[model samples]
Target: MGTKSAFNWVTLWASLLFVVILGFSRLSYGMFLPGIQRVLGGSYGQLGILGTVNFIGYLVGTLCLSPLISRFTDRKQVINRMTCLLLGLTLIGSALSDDFTQLGLWRFIIGLLSAIATVLVLSIAMDAVRPAERGVASGLIWLGGSAGILVTGLFAPFTIDPLHLQGWRYAWVTMGVFGVIAAIGFDFATRKRGVVTIPSQTESKLRDRESENVYRLLLNPKRFLFLITSYFFFGAGYIVYFTFLIPYLVSKGTPSLYTGLIWSGIGFAGLFNGWIGGKAIDRWPSGYTLALGLTLGTIGVFGITTNNLLFTVLGASLIGLVSFITPPLMTTALLRRDIPDHLYAVCLSIATAFFASGQIIGPIIGGIVVERHGLQFGVASSAIFMAIAALLAGLYGLQQRKLEVRDLPISS
Candidate 1:
């Protein structure tokens, strides 16, 4: 294979490993949510808490991974895959959860393990690729998430029974088993002969310090506030759709089978959206691209309101397509805003934390709205957040233009 083809295959394999990491660890919870909730007798608010705990696990992992991995950088590769291994096992163990409390704990473990895998995969895998290819690597890894959703969407309908819950447990066990096998396969394929000392804790510390300093230098209250707040709302808006849409559909008396189809459509749309979004980041002005994405996402969120099946499917497609698109664009915008290479890692990590925090709260608020207003209305409420994110992006773009115009030299 040529260089391009070789890298494509390498990235493809990386993405597939990510699929196992997310599928077994995280997505399975959502896919199995409806049945498991009924089986375990979880209330809507409690289930919302369950989702919140999952992101909290992710948030904790995101915060700790840098420091933890910095302590063992040469073994970072080992650390990453081991996380996958443990993640698979934990997910398998979750099938045994006997109640909502147990299920919540299990999902939290799943979230933690997946977060470690995610931080490792995104950081390590990008390091392995060319600088120009980093965006593509991020897209592929995210596409791996879409694949996870697609697999769950295609599989869950067949595995579920409106009257039976055993299928839910069985599905969890099956994902765990396959995840273990995939994890082992990856380990064998990437097995190496010798250790590289440069990936050491010392390097990690130096890098961390660089990121910290760069972030501090780049700090500007007005501009960074818009970027960070936009990210925060994105985290808030998207999770509502992801966590509750299926339950909403099912509660409305939509068949379990149709719920799977809707989710699968989301996964399918996301595949193309990731690619298109990455390219848009490369070509367009950062704020404008983000503005467009959030606006499209706002339209997608509103699409959830109507009861028509056709409209539901169309809405699901739009929501999926844009769900993961805007975040990457935000990343592009950050990097393009004159950040240096060393600072990119830390800045991105901080921004991602904002997103994760939004995720932590999104489900709670969404759950409250759903509990009080009904599922459709709960989903509709998310649009308000997306609209705000779009507005923030617009303002940021305008701020940049004014700064640019003011920088022009005076005429003699």
Candidate 2:
């Protein structure tokens, strides 16, 4: 293949893998939650606990990833493929589950598998691109989740009643089959590819110096703290919005079909995230891009709190446009830019661990708020957390600006 063709081919398979791992395994739960609850007969609080369990598993997976990769460096591809396959099997297991405990077990396993697959796949994909293009590539990879959300939104809600209360089960089965296919294709596509290496001695020395600087920055908590904190808050905030969105809409007397459509709209709007948000990341500072996305997300979440259908639709669309994937894409791009290629996966795994920790808390708190105050208050709480995330990202941006200014060469 030509160089351009090779890039496209690699990106395509990687994004497909993301569709299965991040999209189907991770994000699809929120869309299917109401249907699952109907069949399993659980309170919102109980379902929220399931979400927490899944995130906890994700946290464990992220924590374990660095060591596992070091131990099996030569077998990264095998690990990635196996993780994806296991995630697919777990989704299928979820479909067969008859009780809440069974479903939660599958979810936890899914989370663990998905976390490992996500970091590995993203590392592999980013390796294919030059540093300048990593931002766009990351956005495109994340866009696969938007596609998953669209697919789930289209069928999950409607499936509940049409298949004699087995719609959710069928949905899980379908997602599992698709995930398996994607994993097989991903394995084939990436089999011959490897991480790109720098060839110039001069460039290698420069990279080493830059890597040392980045390591120092990381060691200084003042310089690196805000970025991880922003990630944590963003994770906590967005999961709540997605987890309860469908149920909240239904509670407000909206029809299931309409709710599905609204969810689909969010996904459709997200289609532009790779292009729009990626361009923003490419042109602006990473922290600024992250802060902008979070600010818009905060507004979008607050819009949903109004509980007005039109406003909610607009809110959901806004969220789809920037919030869902933008923060992580920016975070990854920033880290990829500063961290050495060899250290990329380990640093990203650490960052994702922080993100996962927030996710573990988000659903539990959101459920309690919903149970006590109402869904509106629960969603409003998400907006508040997102607002805090925006603030932290903005501070990070300002800090980056100061560093850039300090590093500039003096002229005679």
Candidate 3:
């Protein structure tokens, strides 16, 4: 097979693993939220803060470990070991939590581990694939994310009954246990020989040098400035949609069981969106594809704000579709830009940390908005954030065009 074709297969497998692991780790939060609230009996304000705590942990983990992996040229083994370790910790945390305070602490750690595992997989895929394939590669990776959401939603309703047992705890433990088992199985399966791809010695050494250089280059204060700014807003805007869409739907009079199903639809659509988004990125400019998705999100959020049930459901699906399109497009854009491969993990990790920071702040902001104005306005507010992101993204595309012109030697 050609190099691009081979990489496509590799990205697909890696992404599948990531989506399964990430879906279980991240989306399960919603499944357990209600059960936990019953025991804690806090206002929406308090629960929102607790959600922020989990995201804080996620942000920290992504920021700390994304760069840490740069120190190790071959981190596949480390990734394996850490994945299992984190999963085991998750199970232990779930089984032992005595109250909300303790549960929040454990949840935080779980969020960190979840970020590490997902980012690691993405980093490896980016490192291994050709640039031309990145969009598709990213799309494949996000398919696993969609699957993760499906798993959590499917299991949460059947697995948890707050009044009967610690259904919330049970749900968490099950996901953790399964993750551990999957990790062990993956470790054993890959133990035989040289499965990981490494560059030639000269290229490898060059890559290592470039990794350190990227830190200095990023300090240029102008090169990636627009992309960086756009990323932060993207984080804040995208997360509000991800974290609250289902809950908002439920409040609007969608039945609880249907809420779970809607969550499932989000995941299901994301599975296709990742693949479609990635392919679109490959066929066209990353900016156009990304802007398209963000625009869809803006329109969807605006529709939700109107509070019509049919519009709400349609809007939710559009948001989900648009949301899934983002990761692959944005991540591929980052990878293809001026950044180097060796430091890709760290840079993306740091970006994710900022993304996490947005997550950390988004819910608290949402809570305050909900309290002061109302949930509809709170939900509608995501459109403002997404609109800003889309606008900035458009500017970045123009900036890139200008750079292309500048590099043309003033000839044309």
The best candidate by TM-score is: 2
Report lDDT (CA) for all predictions. Answer: 0.69, 0.80, 0.64
Q: Which window of ten consecutive residues has the lowest lDDT sum in model 1?
A: 403-412
Task: Quote each prediction's TM-score.
Answer: 0.87, 0.91, 0.86
What TM value does model 2 have? 0.91
Please give the TM-score that candidate 1 achieves against the real structure.
Answer: 0.87
**Candidate 1 residue pairs that clash:** none
User: Model 2: per-residue lDDT, tens digit, 1-412?
Assistant: 1123224666787787777776688888887777777788888888888989999999999989977865555577788889988888889888999897888888889988888988998887777777677778888888888888888788855664434477878888888988888888877777655443333656545544444444345535446678888999999999999988877887787777788888888888887886677668877845887998999989998787665789989998999998887888888887777666766777788889989999998999999998999877887789877998999899888887877622432110
Q: Model 1: runs farther than 4 Å from truth?
A: 1-6, 185-208, 214-219, 222-225, 325-343, 396-412
285-311: candidate 1 lDDT, tens digit per residue = 456677788888888877777777788
Tell how far residue 93 is off in model 1, in angstroms.
1.2
Report residue 308 deviation for candidate 2 (angstroms).
1.2
Give the per-residue lDDT of model 3 (tens digit) for 78-166. 77467656755575576577877887787787777777876666665565557667767677777777877766666545533434356
The whole-model C-alpha lDDT of candidate 2 against the native structure comes to 0.80
Candidate 3, residue 367: Cα displacement in angstroms equals: 1.8
Residue 387 of model 2, lDDT score? 92
Better structure of 2 and 3 per TM-score? 2
